[model samples]
Target: MLLLTLYIIGITAEAMTGALSAGRKQMDTFGVIIIACVTALGGGSVRDVLLGSYPLTWVAHPEYMVITSVAAVVTIAIAPVFRYLRKLFLMLDAVGLVTFAIIATQKTLDLGHGIIIASIMAVVTGVFGGVLRDILCNDVPLVFRKEIYGSIALMVALLYHSLTTLLHVPMDYAVIITLVAGVLVRIAAIGFKLDMPQFKYNSPEH
Candidate 1:
């Protein structure tokens, strides 16, 4: 139930982001739909494949795809009303990241994985779809650039592992801690205009 809720929230956020971004780029309805679907399902598809879970989540359920499509259409139609969609996208994405990170960590732990593996899987689940969507749209992935995106994922996973194993915290408490930490970090990042350090490479010898 918890996992399903997280998945739904993540998909909704992804759909909104895709719709806004695609509409901004002047994509047609079909293009918007495609981007939304890709954004919503890309990460879960990769995670399921890696975990050897056949038929993928959306493939088996199918409702997720339908919901994503509808969300894209609605977002596109309402784009004008939501003039600050870029800010909305950032907020929703932050919530979705926290939800996905917690879900991934719990799921991996349930599958009897080690802490390290769970943490890695958590990051993958939290950021992979956004990465794919940005790459396909010819933009830098948020996880790889601006804000403390990947760090939020990593911190959430580590907190889950630490609270659970070291302090022998209950799963529920661990999940709460993970979610709170992630959300706080994300909110702080946005509130303070936080950004990751950038590299400046020397020009190649001519």
Candidate 2:
């Protein structure tokens, strides 16, 4: 039950970010709703499809879509407030990332999958929605950038794996640790400007 609630919160936060992205692109109401849904639910849908988990969450639970759509519209109504809450949005996004990662890890493991597949699901759930949002907004995909986005997902997955599988820790404890650590590490990365190495080629300019 708690996991389900966290999942909803994660998607809602993601949807708000998506709504902001759509506003930045000056998209219409329909476009904003579409982008919001894609950003909030796209990652989980992708994960389920890849894993052959039928009956997508939004399909099984239409309320989630409604939530995303409403969030998008509300964001449009108060768009200016977001400009002052950029840091708050980042923090929410970080929490959502951890929530998605933790839920993905738990669900995949519950399905009798191995750690590797769980890790992949973690990354898929953590980053794919933002990737879709960026692509739809005609911006560079954040996961492909020189940031610790994918690393955070992997770290959460690894921590979950180690705690539950190896260390024999309880699910609640593992989740708490992973969620708190993931958010802190993400915030630290943001604050310290920590990033992965980027590739630069001296090719001729077009």
Candidate 3:
């Protein structure tokens, strides 16, 4: 139940971000809705396909789509206030990322998969939706940037897996710990401008 609630919040937050991206590109309402839905659900869909999990979340529960669509429309309605809420949006996005990672890790484990695969799927589910959103918006994918986005996802996955699988922590406690830690790390990274070292390559002119 906890995971389900967080999952809904994550998807709604993600949809708002996607709607913002679409608005930046001056897309129409229909386009905004499409991008929002894709960004909110694309990662999980990809993960399920890769893991061979039948009946995707949105497929199993169409209400999720309705929720995402409503969130997107609300985003569009309140687009003007976004400038003041940039930090808030980032915080929400971080929450979404961590929640997605924890949920994906749990899902993979429940599917009888090992921790390594769970970690991988967690990263995928945390970032792939944003990747698709960026591609659609013609912006650079954030995971490729020198930020701690994907790293946070992997960290959340590993921590959750360790707490539950190795240390035998209860699911609720593990989820709470992982979510708080991941969100703090992500916000700190953003606030401090901490990122992985860039790999710069220069070619000499012949």
Candidate 4:
């Protein structure tokens, strides 16, 4: 139940960010709502499938659709208040990443997975939504772009696992610490324009 709440919050934040970014594209209300819903639920859906959970969350509880729709509408109407949508999106994205990572880790642990599996699940949950949103919006996915996006997820998952395993911390504390670390890392990466170096391939000799 706690994980569900956290997932909802993460989805809502991502939906709002999606709506703001969608508005910049001059999408109509329907388009905005569609984008928001997809951005919000995409990752969770992927996580469920990967985790072998049947009847996905949104399918099991339709409230997610209704909530995301309302959030999209409200975000679109209040778009003007947020002048720098990119920065706003980044901040919200960070929150979503943290929240989703915590929820995913908890869920994985609940499913009797070990630390390594739990950490990998956390990364999937944290990143797949943004990847879906970018793909649908015809933009490059942030995880594959000039940012420490996936790395942040990796850090959170590793922290969660380490705390729980090495420090013998409670599940809740482990999740909280992992979340804080993920959020801080995301903010610092954005503030400092940090990114992993890209690999370049040279032409093969004939």
Top TM-score prediction, candidate number: 3
Give one digit per residue, the lDDT tens place, for model 4 in 144-163.
67346667776777777778
Candidate achieving the largest lDDT: 3
Candidate 4 Cα outliers beyond 4 Å, as residue runs? 1-6, 84-89, 202-206
RMSD for all candidates, in order, please. 2.5, 2.0, 1.9, 2.7
lDDT tens readout by residue for model 2, 1-206: 66677778888889998988888898999999999999999998999999888898899999999999999999999888888998888888888888889888888898889999999999998888889889989999877772587899999999988998899998888888888999999999988999887888998998
Question: Model 3, 1-206: lDDT tens per residue?
Answer: 99888889889999998998899899999999999999999999999999999899899999999999999999998888888998888888888899999999999999999999999999899889989898888899867883477899899989999999899999999999998999999878977889888887798877
In Å, residue 105's CA in model 2 sits off its true spot by 1.1
**Candidate 2 displacement at residue 176 in angstroms:** 1.0
Cα miss at 99, model 3 (Å)? 0.6
Compared with the true structure, the alpha-carbon lDDT of candidate 3 equals 0.91
Error of 1 at 95 (Å): 1.4
- What tens digits encode model 1's per-residue C-alpha lDDT throughout 1-206? 66567668778988878777787778899989988888877876777778786778788999999999999999887878777566766677877888777777777788788878777877787778878788778887756674376778878888877888899998776766777777778988879888877878899988
- Among all windows of 10 consecutive residues in model 4, the one with the lowest summed lDDT is 142-151
In candidate 2, where is summed lDDT lowest over 10 consecutive residues?
141-150
Clashing pairs in 1: none
Where does candidate 3 have its weakest 10-residue lDDT segment?
141-150
- Each candidate structure's count of clashing pairs: 0, 0, 0, 0
